[model samples]
Target: MKASHFLFFILLLCICIPASAQEAKMKKIFNGKNLKGWVEPANKACWTVSDGVLLVKNEPAKKGAILWTEKSYQNFIFQADFMMGDGTVDSGIFLRSENDQIQIGISGSLKRDLTGSPYIPKLRYPVEATGVKDLLKPKDWNTLKIKVIGNTYTAYLNGQEVMTYSSADMPPSGPLGIQLHPGNEMSISYRKIMAVAL
Candidate 1:
């Protein structure tokens, strides 16, 4: 083989390798059949799987729970489809730790729908996501996509970019969680829970 041809081939391989590696990193975190890859909450009855959907409802005690991933993720793209159910739905997706969360339903403290916004404990909500009020389908399935890199978070609702915020207090890495806020007789369903490491 010619020397120049060999060099060109090597360069092409270098570019393609990273792309392939990224694709391989894509994973379906939720198996749909059960919570195999997640750390089940203390009240297992609060979370259940039916027809490939992961459902969460308030327990009789009104004590909420958080379903966390068994493994931790640093930087990644997380996506899931959620359908709001009865009562005042209140839930969120915990980014790296419980402190940093993406609000999925109504904010308990705010007393309104703050979907797609970041809810930081103590700090509260630094910024609210726009277009959520118009894009959200209250009775139907809505897709929520979050990209977390470093300390920045960008949220997309139904494939439209809505909000981006940088957090100085977010941890470097931790397990992701799905929240079931207490004191509410509500239920929510999630499907197609996936993440791809960056």
Candidate 2:
């Protein structure tokens, strides 16, 4: 082959090789049979593998108990199917990285009765919760989708765009975790846990 033809071929091969490697890096976080690549947060008793889904039992916590992946993820799309009991069952999904972490999912339902009644938390603060999104359907399964690029995050619930948050403190690469809201007898299950790196 001529010099120019040989040079062109080499450059094309260089670009194609990396693309193939990138595709292999994306993997399903769950095996759909067992918990082989995941780690329970501080609470193991509340989280278990039942049948093919990862079940989160009702065990309240002071802050939030997490079920995070052992491996860290950078810019990727994380998807999971979760089920909650009532409007009382609150939870969160955290995307961790080296410096910054993005939190999504439903933590608690809208509680308007606490205002001017007795006490008020962040949810019941004087102003409507800014970071807080709308409530999810109670006692049913919901699909949460999170897309993280660099330090920015965009989240979706049940095929609807909920909110977008960005930060410099966000971790560029870290494990994905689910928060087990403290102080509730809540049971949640997660199936089809996966991450595809972009």
Candidate 3:
């Protein structure tokens, strides 16, 4: 082959290699067909997949059940689309087990909407998000992005930066969970759950 052609080939390979590696690094936690990678909770009837979306009917008897990821992660980016129906929808995305969770819908008390809020479940204190009221769509799908690096977490709602906070109490690694907070009969759905480790 010509020297110029060989040099161009090398340059092309340099650009293609990183792109392929980056694509391989990202993993889809949800299959959209079934809960294959999720550890099904005791109240299995509450969770189901329909038309490639995970939904919780929120039965009163089966509240507060979390659909947990079988695998755990640390220092990663998680992206998903979620929607909640009318009435009080109290749901959250649990990071690092049951402690650190990004609140998605409303709290039962009706005091805090908590969309895009970074909170510690045990502490009951949330690093509240700003400019989120107008961003969140009621009874409609909203995109949520969360990046956790070490003890620091940054979250966004519908492509808008919401909040960033650091916590020393969170574990280095733990399973990600979707919570159906107890005592509410509100429907919630999640889809396109994708994650990439940093």
Sorted by lDDT, highest first, which candidate order results?
1, 3, 2
What TM-score fits each model?
0.88, 0.65, 0.85
Error of 1 at 155 (Å): 0.5
Best by lDDT: 1
Residues 53-77 of candidate 3 have per-residue lDDT tens digits of 9987677674568999888888888
- Writing each residue's lDDT as its tens digit, candidate 2 over 37-151 gives 8785666777778676877766545454777788887888877777764435555566773233223333344432111110123223222223223445545666777778887
lDDT by residue (132-197, candidate 1, tens digit) is: 989999999999989899999999999899899999888998889999999999999999999997
| Every candidate's lDDT | 0.93, 0.61, 0.84
Q: How close is candidate 1 to the true structure, as a TM-score?
A: 0.88
Could you report the Cα RMSD, in angstroms, for every candidate shown?
4.1, 8.3, 4.7
Model 3 per-residue lDDT at 60: 64
List candidate 1 segments past 4 Å from native. Answer: 1-25
